[model samples]
Target chain A: MSENIAERVKKIIVEHLGVEADKVQDNANFIDDLGADSLDTVELVMAFEEEFGCSIPDDAAEKIRTVKDVIDYIQKQV
Target chain B: MRRVVVTGIGVLSPLGYGHKANWEALVKGQSGLSKIRSFDPTDYVSQVAGHVPVGREIGQFNPDEILSPKEQRHVDPFILYGMAAGQQAVQDLNWLPETEEEKNRFGVYFGSGVGGLMGIINSGKSVETVGPRRLTPFAIPSILINLIGGHLSIKYGLQGPNIACATACATGSHAIGEAARLIRDDRADIMLAGSSEAAICPVGIAGFSQMRALSNHFNETPQKASRPWDKERDGFVMAEGAGAVVLEEYEHAKKRGAKIYGELVGYGLTADAYHFTAPGGTGAKRAILQALKEADITPDQVDYINAHGTSTPMGDLVEFKAVKEIFDGTNVAMSSTKSMTGHMLGAAGSAEAVYTLLAMQNNVLPPTINLDNPEEETAGFNLVPHKAQEKQVTYALSNSFGFGGTNATLLFKKVLNET
Candidate 1:
């Protein structure tokens, strides 16, 4: 289930940002490494919540800046 | 006053995509109206629309050519149509402002009659079904009427005046007319002006259908739906498209050896202040007279008129009465290209303006198709019925009147010789 969550999070990021799957590594920051604005990051968070069937609060969404952050958050929540 | 001339034009209509294709199909008396395929219209009262054909044909529109997948997801179709037409015009003119000074003198003025109704509806449904937090971040910009101009200004790096007119069906005419004013006033050396519309969605059709403003009689025979001035006419057919023109100061265009289509000599706008949806003959007549007066020409000197004939019963006769009152005993031939392109709402005015220029250049007037049984009141005016006509057009007028009784007229004079 943890591995599935990581794959799903990466898929959502790649699809939302139109970024390369290879570039979406665990340590890759959404805004720094991937080309995503503030709004795009928020949208990606919403997409993750919908995919994992969990609610991501606003404060928590702001802390989710990297691919690993999203994977870790989802693994703990869902 | 600095004189203004049309340097380039672009059009994306149900008739065709580019201006050339649209002109060719138009003069051939082709009807672009068909059964609405963008959405299932089984529940809609008016099931026909003039949607831009999607394909790889010379004049057909391909969405992939205009926007990337992610960019497309961020905008509504109106913005895409506007950008497509605007890019065509910019490319046709080959005038890219490179220096900061030049960029500051370039601007974009585009509009839509009803902007992004589909986007709004879809966004609302998403928020309703899911939650408000699930809404896309681009929803607000996607539904903005002025985003067309905003997007164009950003893409082209235009730093001058960027604005939009939202006068319902008259949006295109108002945009072009006001943009010409900007050039004439020396605020901008060159301006891209036009209007786009993509409001043939379910709610748009339903709203107009509720007002009995759309034709529902000929859904099975879609081509015969928008019969302007004909006795069998019902209501206007909804359409989606965009039309844009590049307006430059006469001396500036001449200095650059630009190919001038024609000179925009007169622009007039007036309010009816009488009815919301119906035309007050007085205001339309005043607008026509105002344009002719500003052009310093009599009604007899005008050769052609592209009328705001939307195929509605009351609107057609009212506009005709106004034309007759103004052009009485004159040989000014008039035709409604809406008979072919359908009612493109905000795009109608600029598209008709482009058609008027083509008519003057080629000396061939587009026809008002489906006018087999012309109404008795339309007897005096040369309605250019059923087929295109070849006649040397000197001065032509394109008229657009919107729902709020806003009327605008643009007068164009053919340039016989290069100065």
Candidate 2:
């Protein structure tokens, strides 16, 4: 279940950043690998919030750095 | 300075689609106001407008008509309206320049206040639902105010200076005056000039409703809503249309055997800077005086004044005061055509100019309808209320004042001699 959730989150990141799914792995950083600016990152978080039906606060949004971080946050919130 | 004369005129107003029909309707004192059928205004405070009814077929985008189908789809309705009127002006006068120099020396000058409001509203909806990526590439070009001039230049193959002046409601007057200046300064032999507007959209209605700048008293009786100078007047009823006129140099037009209507004698422009939206009334007086001085005519020499009474309480009162100050108790025939056509915004100036010329040509002044009881402040002047009056008008002045405190006054005189 955990692996499945991580795969789903990674797919979303890859689609949002226009990158390959494999490149947006658990260990890869969003800025370094996925190539997202500050606004893009914020928008990505908003899309995730809407898609997952989860509320991500500003502080929690700041903590999300990678696809794995988003998966973890969604897991904890849901 | 060179002299300029009106050679041709065309219009698509609330009364009808052509000048003759509109003139007939005006002479019959018919009202064009009706309930808002273009959009459902059940929730809107102001629920009426003078809309050009749908299903009236303006000829297709043939090369002879105006523009191509592709180009027509990308432009706003105002531009389409302008093109229709421009094409009619060209056809009515059979203005076929045989030489390249004649074509090049002809230019276009048009104006619009709120261009492509319908386009903006559609784009706004698309952006909200499908995101900004769904916005069409032609959205900005279609909505820009100057596209009226661009479309005219392209359609007619005019190569001279193409310009557009967007000064809110005064746009039409400014455009006509500027085109005349081009002729007066010997810049162009012929100039296509006018203004158009299509601001009767959801956002436009909502914005004007929020500002309380539109009439709300006659949601049920829309025809009686736009009552200018009446004690019961509330606010102006929004209107949409276009008006165009072809101005040519006196000797040049006569040499080409063009039928001239009247001579454009003077144009005066001024700014109130008193308030953002309201006129100072004094500044309008100055503009009128400046136009009189430029025309070298006294107040009594002016026989008719087409007043820009928008039916708004403040606007009507301020225009009355301004006219009084300009005329100084002299008997001058004045009438607010907004009472019949509603407020055409940027198109009002040009539409009123056409009416003024028609009055000069026919020796009749159209009445200000819907005025059952004149307001206290509006009683002094000869408002020409209720019924059309017959008068021998030699010289006429038309005034148009818009938001941002901008004002323009134009003087026209009946052509007496070829020189």
Candidate 3:
């Protein structure tokens, strides 16, 4: 189930940011490594919430800075 | 107060792309109307429209040549057409603003009559048939009306007042007039002022046809659909397109060695305060007189007028009566290019304004083609019917009266030859 969450998180990141799928590694930082600005990060979180059927708070979204972090948050919420 | 001068022009009409193509088509008195190709039009009564050509004809629009795959998804065709004209105007001026101050001094006042009516209609139908979850995120941004100014300003990094006017068919004229005021009021040194429209869609066709505002009898001969001032005229032919101009301060443009097209000498805006759909004779006449007054010129000084003759039974006569009442004794050669290119709604005023400048430059008045038999009211004015005429035009005017009795008149002075 965690593996499925990781894959889904990577998919959302790729689709939302137009990034290559393989580059969305688990530990890659959204801003430093994935080339996301503040606006992009907010949109990515919204896409995650819509796709995963989860509601992320502002502080919770701020804590999610990588693909692995997004997966962990979604799993905890579900 | 800064005097506004037109240094560049961009056009995307049913006739073709850019100022040269549209001017050439206008001078040749060619019509761009045909059986509706954007949609089936099988269900609509008025099946004829002046759609912008997209195929490999001599002067057709090729979307692939303009926008990228990703950029195309973020905006509607209204934005695309407006951007194309804005890009052309920028390129024509060869303007490269490298400083933040230069960017801040440049602005865009572009507008449209409707807010992506076709895009909204298409998506609304899709949502009903396919559900809300199927809608794309870009749908909302793409449907917003003011995105033309937003998109064009972002593309060129113009940081001044980005305004959007939505005064029905008078949107373009109001945009130009307002932008010129912005320059005159020392708010901006330059402005990209105009409008765009691509409403040749299912709803646009049905809505206009239901109101009996579009030409229908000439479906078999679509080229003759928009016969303005002619007795055979039934209604306006709906056309889809855009037009733009780079308006700059006169001394600033002169300093930059910009080739001035014309001078925006005056602008007049008024309201009917009488009717919603029907035009008010008093308001329209007052608009014309006000424009001439602001220009500090008498009615006789004007040589040509590109009329907002939509070819409708009431509108055509109403505009003629107004112009006649104002410039009755003046030898002003008036014509409506709408006879050939159809009425382009929000883009109509700017498009005709561009054509008016072209006429002043070419020194040849464009013919109001398909004017087989001019009505008695149209007989007094030199309606330049069925054939082009060479008139040493130095000053010209363009009128745009729209729904809700919104009236606007823009007067331009020839400025290229003086230097």
Candidate 4:
């Protein structure tokens, strides 16, 4: 389940930001490394919530900045 | 005052993709209108439209060449079409500002009759079904009328005056005329000016159909639906496209050895001040004569006219009567490319202006198709019906009238070597 979550997070980031799949590493920051603006970050959170069947509030959403952060959050919820 | 001349033109019209393709199709009297294919129109009153074909063919428009699939997902079709046409015009002009001063001296003036109507309508549906939280972050920028100019300015590093006029059908003409005024005032040396529109959506069709402003009589024979000045004409057919031109200061263009299509010597803008939807008074007449006055020429000096003939009963006849009143004795030939390209709304004026320049360049007037029985008022008028005519078109004029009684006229004089 953990490996599946990691693959899913990378896929979403690659599709949303139109970046290379290899660049969406667990430690790579969405803003600093992946080139996402504030709006794109917000949209990425929404996509994650829909995919995982869970809601990430605004306060929690602000903390999600990397592929690892999304995997950890979704793992805890599911 | 600096004079302005048209150096490059680009078009993405129902007739074709490039200006040359559109001009060839127009001269051959081909109809771009057909049963709506973008969406199912069986439920709507007016089911015909002139939509841009999508492919990699000779005249088809392929948006992938301009934007990636992900990038295009954020922007509306109107902006995409405008960007494509603007890029084509800039490339045609072969000028990209590399220096700070050159960038500062470049500008953009683009407009649209209705910007991103489909975007707004889809967002409204999302709000009702999935709520606003699911809406995309690029919603606001995608729907703004001025974003076309904004995107073009950013792409070319143009840092001069940037504006987008939203004067309905006259938006294109007003954008070009106002950009010329900027050059004439020495504000900018070069400007990309024109308009784009893609509002042939469900709500757009319903709105115009409710107002009885579309042709429903020939949905079965879609090509014949947009017959401007014809006795069987009912209303105009909506179209989606863009037309862009590179307008440069005459001296600047000449110094760069740029090809000048024609010189835009005069333009006139006026309002009827009478009704919201219907045209009134001598506004059309006054606008044309005012343009002639500014051109410093008499009525007989004019050769060809691209009329604001939108196939509607009242609009076509009123424009015809005005032309008759002004060019009664002159052997001026008039034609409505709308009879082929349909009514592109905001893009109509700019596309017709490009067509007028082509007419002067090729000395051939595009014809108004499907004029089987002309209106009685058009007895003595040379409406250039059914077939293209070859004539020495030295001076040409294009007219555009819009809702809220706005009118704009642009006069183009062929560039003779002596001048």
TM-score of each: 0.97, 0.81, 0.88, 0.97
**RMSD of candidates 1 onward, in order:** 1.5, 10.6, 3.4, 1.4
Distance from true location, Cα of B112 in model 1, Å = 0.7
Q: For candidate 4, lDDT tens digit of each residue in B50-153?
A: 99988999888999988878778778899999998898899899978889999999999999999999998888887789888888778788889999999999
**Could you tell me which 10 consecutive residues in candidate 2 chain B have the lowest summed lDDT?**
B55-64
Of 3 and 4, the candidate ranking higher by lDDT: 4
Residue-by-residue lDDT tens digits, candidate 1, B1-419: 79999999999999888988999888899999999998899998899999999899788998888887878899999999999989888888888999999999999999999999999999999999987887999999998989999989988999999999999999999999999999888899999999999998889999999999999999999999999999999999999899999999988889999998899999989999999987774888888888998999999999999999999999998899999988889989999999999999998998888999999999999999999999997886799999999999999999999989999999999987755
lDDT of 3 by residue, B337-397 (tens): 9998998999998888889988988899999999988897776679998889999988999
lDDT scores of the candidates, listed in order: 0.92, 0.83, 0.86, 0.92
- Model 2: per-residue Cα lDDT over B30-54, one tens digit each: 7888998888899999998988644
Q: List the residue pairs that clash in candidate 1.
A: none
> Which candidate leads the pack in DockQ?
1
TM-score of chain A of 4: 0.97
What DockQ would you assign to candidate 3? Answer: 0.15
- The local lDDT score (0 to 100) that residue B391 gets in candidate 1 is 92
Please compute DockQ, using alpha carbons, for every candidate against the native two-chain complex.
0.83, 0.02, 0.15, 0.69
lDDT of 1 by residue, A1-78 (tens): 898888988899889999899999999998999989888888898899889899999999889888999999988987
Query: How does residue B147 of candidate 3 score in lDDT?
Result: 88
Minimal lDDT window, size 10, model 4 chain B: B66-75
TM-score of 4: 0.97
Question: RMSD in Å for candidate 2, one decimal?
Answer: 10.6
Q: Candidates ranked by DockQ, best first?
A: 1, 4, 3, 2
DockQ score for model 4 = 0.69
